[model samples]
Target: MNAEMQVILDQLEEENLGIRKKAIEALKKWEYQLELEDACLLLEKAAEIKPLCEDEWDNPSYALVTAACIFIHEDMVPVIEKNILRYSLRAAIKVLSFLLVLNTESAISLYKKTFHQFYDHGFACTGV
Candidate 1:
């Protein structure tokens, strides 16, 4: 990996959650350049880090989810599904966006299956 990628990866390993969140945000800039190995590494790290983020003001799950989408890997769905309900509305919307980008038919089917769940989870509001 390049020095820039190295730094981001190092940041992701930091004990400071804020630093890790910033690292995820930084990964967004590397979307087009990320190799498969790097994307997988990032996805693994993000999956591990995402569940630890509990603060509403400092959540990194959204950035992590978007980074997975940016990588365009087939593995994104499981990662998204694992945490969809835990994410804030903003992050859940990102899940929907990823589905739309993946396939309309699949998105429609998944939406049909989960629409009630989403509504029951209090995701029916229009306001962001």
Candidate 2:
């Protein structure tokens, strides 16, 4: 990763949520400059962070997911599938859109599973 990418990655660990959100925004703005390695790292980090909001704008993790989707690869599928259920509906939809484009068959299966999971179980963590 480049120095700039490393710095942004560090910002994700900051105590201040605003800083983390800005770091994710910076990643989006610098998407063209991100290598596959950088995207992979960002995706990993982003997936681990809980979203700050239901809307994508205020959710750093969701924003990062969208940005990372630009560099989507076959290897990233597991991460995407594993994390989708944990995301807010809006963010999950955004992720599902990318999955659809990446691999329709898997995406369809995941979509069904996600829909069933959400419909049957609801979000236990969010109480929604």
Q: For each candidate, what TM-score against the reference?
A: 0.60, 0.72
lDDT (10s digit) by residue, model 1, range 1-128: 55786787677667788787777678656555466666555445544544344565444545655665674555555555555565646656776766767775555566555566887766742212
What C-alpha lDDT values do all the predictions have?
0.59, 0.66
lDDT of 2 by residue, 2-87 (tens): 88778876887776778877887886686554676666666666656665444455555666667777857766667767667655
| Index of the highest-lDDT prediction | 2
Q: Could you give the C-alpha RMSD of every candidate to the true structure, in order shown?
A: 5.0, 3.4
Off by over 4 Å in 2: 33-37, 51-57, 123-128
Worst 10 residues of 1 by lDDT: 43-52
**Cα distance off (Å), candidate 2, residue 2:** 3.8
Give the runs in model 1 whose Cα sits over 4 Å from its true position: 1-10, 33-57, 71-75, 124-128
